[model samples]
Target: MNAPAHDNGRLALMLNELRLPTIGRLWPEFAERSDKEGWQASRLLGALFEHELAERAKRRIERHRNESHLDPSKTLATLEFGLLPMVSKAHVMALASGESWLEKGATILMFGPPGTGKSHLGSAIGHALIDVGYRVLFTRTSELVQKLQAARKSLQLPSALAKLDRFDLIILDDLSYARKDQAETSVLFELIAERYERKSLLITANQPFSGWNDVFPDPGMTVAAIDRLVHHSTIFELNVESYRRRKASDKQSARQRQLPEKNQEGGTTIMS
Candidate 1:
């Protein structure tokens, strides 16, 4: 039998007050199914709760993903692993699982030339970690540095860093773009120092260790930053040819093959 309108309204009110939105919306349908199938009270109640929990988990992930600033298109499935032969698929899968390393506040450093898929891999890893319930923030190293510099100028640097601490992992893309000035590098170093051994960092850079002096400006600071990052880190050196360059070459070849040919009479003729 269907619940009376008054009873249904009262139950919805109570559910809303209790903040059980999924259960509130679903219970009516489930109640009908229960009656039709002669499901016991316990079984119906369990089914409702299972759905509520599942929906809550999904919503939580969506909220976290929105806050993460990750590109929805950049996921492990979309990553072109064939172009990145130097990177081990198994190793990336292991990192995606985020097993023991994330808890230990490990780091992932990706060093590669421009267009070599470093940023794509880093963002893919970020998406994977978020799927497994880790909060992640993906931002350009230059942008984050500017924000930190602004916070420092306002004397709220600590508060700013604390806000970032809530994220399980922070992916700093294009770290080489951060200007090599004391003001900018100092705050950047402060962030690295604050998160050391407490939270994870995933950095994508076009520069290697020796070239980081152009990023840090100070020899001592460069060493310190590299030390902390490399301490418990997994490094991926993407030494492959540029993906963009390869794609451009392929497009050129295709266009050349599609071009009209010169016939015996010296007139252009379309390819058959």
Candidate 2:
């Protein structure tokens, strides 16, 4: 072989032996292009890999959360323009500042009517707490009651309550959405009793203390639950008008209105 041809062949073999990805090596132009655009090739690749890994991790986390029957996605961070009491925010920040949920049991009760953003605030706090590496569990009141009932039927009520005790903060959203019987009350009280001083709880309700008698089905149990929950709980009564009502505009209502049409027998029918 000619000397020049031999040198070229050796150089090609060495490039192949380098074992860089074909795109990263033979297509070095793309790498330079990415760099000329003020982007780091390695960083871009790293970012892509990181994003892909994070996406996989997120999917796995979502699956585990689903299987655990606790929805972390319901937290307040996901709400649009969420608002919480100024003092409540300070208290919440103080709780999170402790760097641990086990430091002290801080319970929050967000009570208001429907569409009042109670769930949003509760869920956001849960998310924030979880972000700080605290074990936070979020579930609707109805769902929690149902699970408690099932656990009782299986003779695992204590275990269920104990598991709840493990959470740094347990967020019960939408309380009083449905009525609860005495049996449910007993089960719920067991949970509260177990976590009395061990963990924190965040509750969002559509009803106030006065209306809770309808939920517990007995004045005694209602008082018991309220006492345990409110003993060290931070009660935030969100008395603002329903968010849905505030968002509705008169022009929107006018546009949504329907014109009246003359029907048979000369009677006008409003077509809504």
Candidate 3:
């Protein structure tokens, strides 16, 4: 027998009040299906609960992705893994799972020349981790350092750092650009120190450790920062041709191939 109209209205009201929007919208169709198939009450309840949980997980992932500020285009699926021969796809996939290392607050340091896909790989990792229910934040190291510096001047540096702690991982892209002066590097160091062994960091830098003296003002500060990051860390040195340069060269070659050729009489002839 069909539920009375008043009973259905009351159930809808109760579902809305209880904030079960997904179930509320879906229950009528499920109820019809259950009636048609003669499903037991337990099965109907289990189905509803499963759908509710699934929808909740989906919404949570979407919310986290928006807040992550990751480039939507950069993901593991879109990355040209073949070009980065030094980076093992198997290893990256394992890290992307984010089960073991992220929980331990391990760091991921990517060292490479510009346009070599360091930033792309870092962003891809962030996207992958987010899919597994970890919150992430992606920002240029220089931009984040400036914000921290401003927070420091306003006496809200701790608050800023605390806010960042909510993210399971923070990806600092282009770290070499943040080596402006003492104030900026100090704030950056504080961020590194604050998250040490507590939250994960994924940093991409154009310069290797030997060239980091240019990044940190003092040698002692440099050592401390490196020690904190390198401890329990996974390092990826991307020694590959610049992706941008290769792409441009490929485009140029294709255009040259498409250009019309001159015939023996100097007249342009289209090549088939």
Model 3 per-residue lDDT tens digits across residues 36-143: 999999999999999999999999999999999999999999888878888899999999999789888999999988999998899999999999999999999989
lDDT of each: 0.90, 0.65, 0.90
Which segments of candidate 3 are over 4 A away from where they belong? 1-6, 248-272
For model 3, the run of ten residues with the poorest summed lDDT: 257-266
Q: What is the TM-score of each candidate against the true structure?
A: 0.89, 0.60, 0.89
**Tens digits of per-residue lDDT for model 2, 62-177:** 54445434445545445444343333555655554445445667578888888766776666666555554466777877778888989999999888887776677787877777
Q: What does the lDDT read for residue 236 in candidate 3?
A: 93
lDDT (Cα, 0-100) at 14 in candidate 2: 70
- Model 2, residue 186: what's the lDDT? 61
Query: What's model 1's TM-score?
Result: 0.89
**Cα lDDT of model 1 by residue, 128-152, tens digit:** 9888989999999999998998999
TM-score of 3: 0.89
Candidate 1 lDDT at 128 equals 92
